[model samples]
Target: MSAPSTPPAADAARRPARGRPPRLDQARTVEAALVLLDESGLDALTMRRLADAVGVQAGALYRHFATKGDLLTAMAERMLADCSTPPPDPDWSGRLTALARRLRTALLAHRDGARVYAGTHSTGAGTLGFAETLIGVLGEAGFGPQEAARTALTVVHYTVGHTLEEQAALQPGDQGPADPERLREAVADAGLPHLTAALPVLTGTDFTAQFEFGLGLLLRGLRGLRRDGSGPGA
Candidate 1:
């Protein structure tokens, strides 16, 4: 009897079936999640949907990521991976400015990318490396450890918040800024002179210019701190 006939069930267990799904790993799972995020926005990137995209069951995703938050953190890390390279500017301020711009560009690479990044406190290599670069630059500019940390946080908050608004305004079906004429009329009717006067620039969609302007303001303040020796380094 053919060596008692090895059990068919045991043979099947030893080798994967022809059409079985590929093994799911953290990297592949995060990649699939990002694709889903780009195609359908953050609100639509659920684990079930991601699992489907990766040819696996939702439970299988948990084997790689314990929770949806874990997956999102990984996605956030991937978004910042390219930003690890330091800029080549000779001046510290110039380097900081370039780094900030690089950060904005990275966040804008994928749909709802800023939102995804804003939600997670990723301690991954990419995130830590970016933070280290920023702090190192500030240190070279005369900021003490505490001051450098706070300054870094402030700059990051500004960049992320600005990009968040920028992305939200550009979302499909979003009404975007109110029409200039309509906004002026409403502000005039409300007797808000200052708001009426600022409407031209206020309602403008020049995110790049606005970002640069805001960044300049922060840099100017930092310059003041360094000049006056008011920061902790002093």
Candidate 2:
């Protein structure tokens, strides 16, 4: 007998069969966390909940992420992964606009995504790469280093700010525009002729149009600065 022939069942138990289901990993962990976030906002995404979602013990999450903040930073970076991709458009302004649009779309894709992103200053691969792209475009477009950095920050801040407000407005509560008649009455009572005349446009907000319009204004200013050689210290 060959040492009483080790039981096949025992051998199989000692070594998981080839192609055994994959263990939980960082990518899968992030995916699970993101799904929870999309389905039920940020507040509901505790580590325990994430572990359960991924079919692991809560302590297992610590192997991938040291803290909740670490996870949130990872989540923000994941959302920004596409921004690192090179733009097809050659025009600097067009590239910047495209990046901004992509960021907005990513934020809007998840519930409270903007809030999650805005809450962190993550220096992850995706975040740094996106910054590099934005600043690199500005540098090639005749912006000094300082001006280029400022312009990049301006674009990012504007996108984050707008999306933050947009997401906030989506939450359930007294998101009151009130009655149309009441709004008209208030505007009429204000007695500012210019504002009164423009009340309809002001009261009816189109966020997409507003974002593009604001971005256009920023780009136009950068263009003017470049043409006049008045960028930064110049």
Candidate 3:
């Protein structure tokens, strides 16, 4: 009893719809958000924009990120993911120097990367692991837990603050503070003797040298404190 076979076109028409593609997961969403950040800066990285970039509705993002802050924290975590381990150095100062430089490099990689990391407090694996390594280095160098923790925080703050200024001054189309000649002229006009004296080095575009100089100052202070046996728990 072979009934007439249904028409091929009719059979195809009866198939259920495949529907839209699956929504992006949290990691992919963060990745896309980072791309958007690099392209348009943080102000343009709205959730709606990110959703569009991911080919999903804005509400779909809520499934992964509770809020924009949450997404930002995730992005911050991603930025530090590669910095979990400290560089190999014989001494704590050297290790800290390398770690600080690595962090600056990471923050300078994307547009407003330091801004992305500044406010968010991410307890993610990357952030925590980096902190653990820094603290561990300090501890191994004869610093007690309190001193190690405080020293680690001081290093992080200095690195982030320096990178923030560096990124802002170097941003494209930003001619305000980055103009060495203009700054020098202003200092001279203001009759600021000390500033004028230091203008050459201060206005130089040698951020690496400036950063190293500041780091050396901090390490020297720490060493002095250790030597004086005045540091906490010493």
Candidate 4:
């Protein structure tokens, strides 16, 4: 009798697993990637690394995500979940403020989370829907589409940028002037009278306070622009 023929590689590729749970889908893979990201940071994440974390062949991931960019995009969408809650009734400004706070809190929760966010455009359905809701609220509040869109983007940019800087602020480092004495010495050497005068005000204020202060400035400026048309010949 002829020896039993072995299954060809091509044939095996077409066959399904008999009893094991179905292989992970894109969402599961994405979540696994995010878990790895939280633990290992964005720089250390690789397809091989993710598959190993998820207990699957690296090749199995390709069945879900075709490329790293695809995986990154998926991760970015999950980031928006923190910020994309439904609007609270009759309180648009409150709604917007709450949204920004939520986004900031969520981004701060992970290691280099904002970096993942910054890498992706993050204009997926969930984000766009949130954007639409924001735009509609702003429009009803007397802003045009152009103004609303720009304002929405500004809020998002400020939120992400502030959160990134906050993360850096908290990371262990000697980047800040090491002490009050060092700060005084630097200020005295520079002889910038303004810096010396403001040192006390600036010294103790942490990132949370700075964020609200900066947000107020942007929001105030936007309001001023709307009211007085802060432009030439307006």
Off by over 4 Å in 3: 1-19
lDDT of 1 at 150: 95
Q: Is candidate 2 or candidate 3 better by lDDT?
A: 3
How do the residues 63-114 of candidate 2 rate in per-residue lDDT, one tens digit apiece?
8899998999899989998777867898988988998998899998888999
Q: Tens digit of lDDT per residue, candidate 3, span 1-234?
A: 989877554334323236876546788778888888987898889999888777778998898899999999999999999997867889889998888998898899989999999989999999999999999989988999988999999999999999888888877787634587888888888999999888777767778888999999999999999899898448
Q: What is the C-alpha lDDT of each candidate?
A: 0.85, 0.80, 0.86, 0.72
Candidate 1: tens digits of C-alpha lDDT, residues 1-234: 557656554233323235967787777668777777877899998988887767777898888788888888899999999887778999999999998998999999999988999879999999999999999998998888999999899989999999999999889976555566778778988999889778878888888999999999999988887788886478
Candidate that scores best on lDDT: 3
Clashing pairs in 4: none
The clash number for model 1 is: 0
Q: Worst ten-residue run, lDDT, model 1?
A: 9-18
Tell me the lDDT of candidate 2.
0.80
Question: Model 1 scores what on Cα lDDT?
Answer: 0.85
lDDT per residue for candidate 4 within 28-82, as digits (tens), equals 6677677778767788999998876666788888887788877887787887764
In model 1, the clashing pairs are: none
- TM-score, one value per model: 0.89, 0.81, 0.88, 0.77
| Pairwise lDDT winner, candidates 1 and 3 | 3
